[model samples]
Target chain A: MTNGSLSEIYAKAAYPLLGHGKRNVQVLKEALEQYEGELDSDMYGSGKVIESFQVKMADILGKEAAVFFPSGTMAQQIALRIWSDDQGSKKVAYHPTSHLEIHEQDGLKELHHLEPTLLADRTRPVLLQDLREMEETPACVLLELPQREIGGQLPEYAELEAMSAFCRERGIKLHLDGARLFEVLPYYGKTAQEVCALFDSVYISVYKGIGGVAGAILAGDVGFAEQSKIWKRRHGGDLISLYPYILAADYYMEKRLPLMGRYYEEAKELAAYYNGCHALKTIPRVPVSNMFHVHSDLDKEQLEAAILEATRETGVGFASSIREREGGGCYYEVSIGDRYAEVPQNALQQAFQALGRKLRHTAEL
Target chain B: MTNGSLSEIYAKAAYPLLGHGKRNVQVLKEALEQYEGELDSDMYGSGKVIESFQVKMADILGKEAAVFFPSGTMAQQIALRIWSDDQGSKKVAYHPTSHLEIHEQDGLKELHHLEPTLLADRTRPVLLQDLREMEETPACVLLELPQREIGGQLPEYAELEAMSAFCRERGIKLHLDGARLFEVLPYYGKTAQEVCALFDSVYISVYKGIGGVAGAILAGDVGFAEQSKIWKRRHGGDLISLYPYILAADYYMEKRLPLMGRYYEEAKELAAYYNGCHALKTIPRVPVSNMFHVHSDLDKEQLEAAILEATRETGVGFASSIREREGGGCYYEVSIGDRYAEVPQNALQQAFQALGRKLRHTAEL
Candidate 1:
């Protein structure tokens, strides 16, 4: 909870709500200590440590090979370019809320000349029916497992199978933006290999859920991986050395990879508790992948003030931040991790009760 | 010298010739150790250390702002893209041997749709007369200072000034691929600022002569730097942390930057000695920078065998490899650094004497 970015939150949190991953500086320190016997790493990206990390990730993802990138933004763009070039079409289909479309500042179009077509609605997971309805076919279809922007909702397994078959029949390549794949696995109740089997390529973030410093992994068949290496050099994703990120990633993967199941279990219980509060509501009413939308009737500023007052007076945290909801009022993205998992039911109830007392004078919430 | 790729040469060198940059792992270790008292950098690329380094570079290059990139490939590509977009023309001009043309595998054309026009002959520096005779102006004219592949030669200072003025009058952007800017300054007898002032953008490699692991700096006016940041993010040149490269560059700049003058002086002396040999000839009969081309009457394999035997018997190494020359025999790029600076004049004379003796037995001459 006290990693450099989270230190501000930790200092203020009477109890910090767990998020998608860990950010504890002390824990990171302990993680680096695990590399005790290691001297250092290679001059550039290739070395025993980085190679072993990539091999382990490849095994976990059930891909023929995996290459580490300094940024997911670069990896995803390169993946789309590869698929699009092979098909001789620049068109790629993605959800309106996909990271490539929104977060990357249109790099796909501006840098790589990739044309992205928005599929389905921004509020829900993309469906097979959505693809069938398109006027033109795209060279690739990119699916974000447990879509993040809409509070972590995944398509049903049968629906996903239908969509995969549809893409295969059309000869359209499928790629997975599996940044949150590890955390979402417990809900899917399947191995990573099973989920990735439907796609030609998959990209996972090293830090999003794995608690590495920063890096991304793109995995696929041997040919795709080999070709991506050339693009990686062109895009400047090849670092002089990746050992620091690999060491941290290896330590956390060993410690946290298997613990996602328990984290998801605790998340559902916590969502139920949040729903019990009259001022707050969870989006789906049931947790899917340790995350859901949290809404309050108060506007952004008032809700923030109330939370601050509650924390000041009773030393309890309600949420990280509140922003104007799409419909009205204020909302936040609720993500549960180890910190929230450790909070006792009675203690959480007290936290909500204290926040309620502070918001009693507010009319909206 | 015995890092990874350099181990083969290090094991054989009674004394090895420096080509391009440092590969000494011990020096790299010392560089990393300098940051022992510093905490880890900011989450992304905006820590105090990174900021200071960028500021220092901007000051040295006399630019309004400077940005550090993970690789020179990203920096140059982004710079070309920016100039092309601003000029509303997709054409960029360069010498036939430009790194952007030959080394980057035509990424400009394939990735960004920028058309490259080879403006001048490969045997000599790009002259203003060449641009004047062109039927159409290019979006950007990229000039490499003391062009790396052409035995490190630069245009006359007056000719460079005339080219800058011509581009300005024509509303054409000019960029400098000053990857070896620091080392080439002595030849021009001008500060980096004086040279960079003529171009709209300049890129310098942190590792080429500065001895960092790997990184590059792109500097220009305020607006250009701001625009380049977006491209930097889009290209994935932005890293989670750049403090290691920053720290290493900072250390080496302090230690190595001032010594370039001596290296250049010694390089001239070494070239003079090699030019004296009957079998080996130095390009231009003198070195403009700390590097020159050595063309020998001996073919590639013969040159390698002679160098190996020379090192085995007398413990003096000439080069790593010899490439087939277009005309006949073989040629290699010889770059001088601190290691070469330490060798006495008599030793280099003796080494060249031995090479000439071996080449005497060859029929290629």
Candidate 2:
């Protein structure tokens, strides 16, 4: 009878999973039972919950302090901004596909008024020589661990250490975009603390891999984070209270972190299985983490419909189609999380089988 | 024993009253029960709950579209960034104490890489002539209704209308920093639509007077907002879902918006009462909105301790000290909301009596 009918198509098209639903309910209950007062001032004015979360995040990341923000975009951008401001320069260097450069609509240039010196080669990791060759000195250098656009590939640990040293000698602050850090941990065979130690500041997303409702933590030295708090307030990132996210994050971390190793193993197995399949080809033969891209022969839309139908009928989940690659077929990113890891390998084979059937049916018609 | 003490003074603060615990719990339960597997895709992402709130907000603010952000800081910064990008200039004009300036550690300068042409005369409303007098044309101008730092005073509607006309004539965009716009509305006898109609874009906080957990809405023409979505994702404000704040905001708008008029009337009466008191002084003789600054003769820390003690004993929540004003006394801000309105007026008078007694005790000792 209302606007619900108009959006029903979208509602039906989306995947329905148990983890997302359970997290939503848990957050809602926390909101109702705990938070009730002036939204702006309640959190910023005197609520100690955000401060507690910051301290916890700082301790976890092995930093002196941490600040919780509404988005990693602001966290990373602000880190760059602070680095630039301290150096009294307007230049920041980062990968060409860095979230700030591609995603922020030139916010660095437009909002923070800084200039980005883009490192152009997309296929390889940024080397010290590339940074040293820049005609102008940059205020900071940003590195995204397991870059998202490139299917979560990471630079070698030795190269990262060299990059850190290079930045330090030149007095450039280093910032890490660890949005999918949990995924990268198993690939590096390193602790979160160890990886974060190399950067002056590290930003980690709570909702992405941790499976909390929504939040991010920007961890750094006490002075750096203290400065970030001022920036957070200015950017309007400080909330009324962060207890719901904090509490849920605490719970999720305990439950999900241990399962990541299993997820990584499952993803590797899935990749191997897909490589052997006649109808599909995986972009990366060996995924560095729990996610890899799959290229399929089936039409993108038809493949999606078949997958959705199968998921609805059989109660299994998998991505249907990602963006079309440079070549003829479409690429779908298969991510292994706590729940997805539990899906039987045969179920995935069945999903592809369903896609084949749908393609055959369409051809006959 | 449990990692850290939860009973610390900072930890014992109250949670914001923003959403219905039962409804939030129920929705979260349903999400977990019905839609746990479909968390990644953007099409029907469980985050649609946040989208629902945005739709409702757009309707309330009389905008073509609205985007929900994790933080008001990110929302407003992106709003200004979009305005500047559209205008092809990077300078935005606003009050010196505007959240973008005073609070953000110059992030507009550092992160967005934009410059503020400060329009710093705090004595009067920003007039059309102010824009005319600028040495160089600015990309955008921001107006903070019920300016927070200056005791919540707002410019006259006629003046704001003239400012809007000036911006249109110059092809400059006007942005309304309506962080506390709800408080200013009843005083001006205007709806949110009327106030927002004067600007190209408007930013409203859900957690401020509305009393929800942290969130903000940036409402504008659909085109401007579509661009903001890109900026939102880049800033990391886009969450897996926003149902908790959205549902709470929807409930708050219905329950709180109607009651703001009553809070405004009460604030006016309270301002009048404080003005008549010989020992206490109200900064602005007439209450422009629900918030006002109080200058008290009592010592800052002792007065704060006394006020907290009185609040605990009497269940009256009011001003806590912010900073020292020009006089020997300290300045405190009183923001009237639904909770404070429920307490009888006599509680305020009783609190004042308690304050006087505490001050006298300090002097005698």
Top candidate, metric lDDT:
1
lDDT of 1 by residue, A185-244 (tens): 898898999999989999998776666766789999999998888888777666666555
How does candidate 1 fare on TM-score?
0.88
Backbone clash tally (model 1): 1
DockQ class, candidate 1: acceptable
TM-score of each: 0.88, 0.79
DockQ per candidate, 2 decimals: 0.31, 0.30
Worst 10-residue lDDT window for candidate 1 chain A reads: A1-10
Candidate with the greatest TM-score versus the true structure? 1
Residues B106-205 of candidate 2 have per-residue lDDT tens digits of 6577557788887856555466677878888888999998888877777788888988998889898999989888878888998989999999999988
Compared with the true structure, what per-residue lDDT tens digits does model 1 show for residues B257-323? 8988888887898888777766788875678788888888676777676666665555566776667
TM-score, B chain alone, candidates in order: 0.93, 0.82
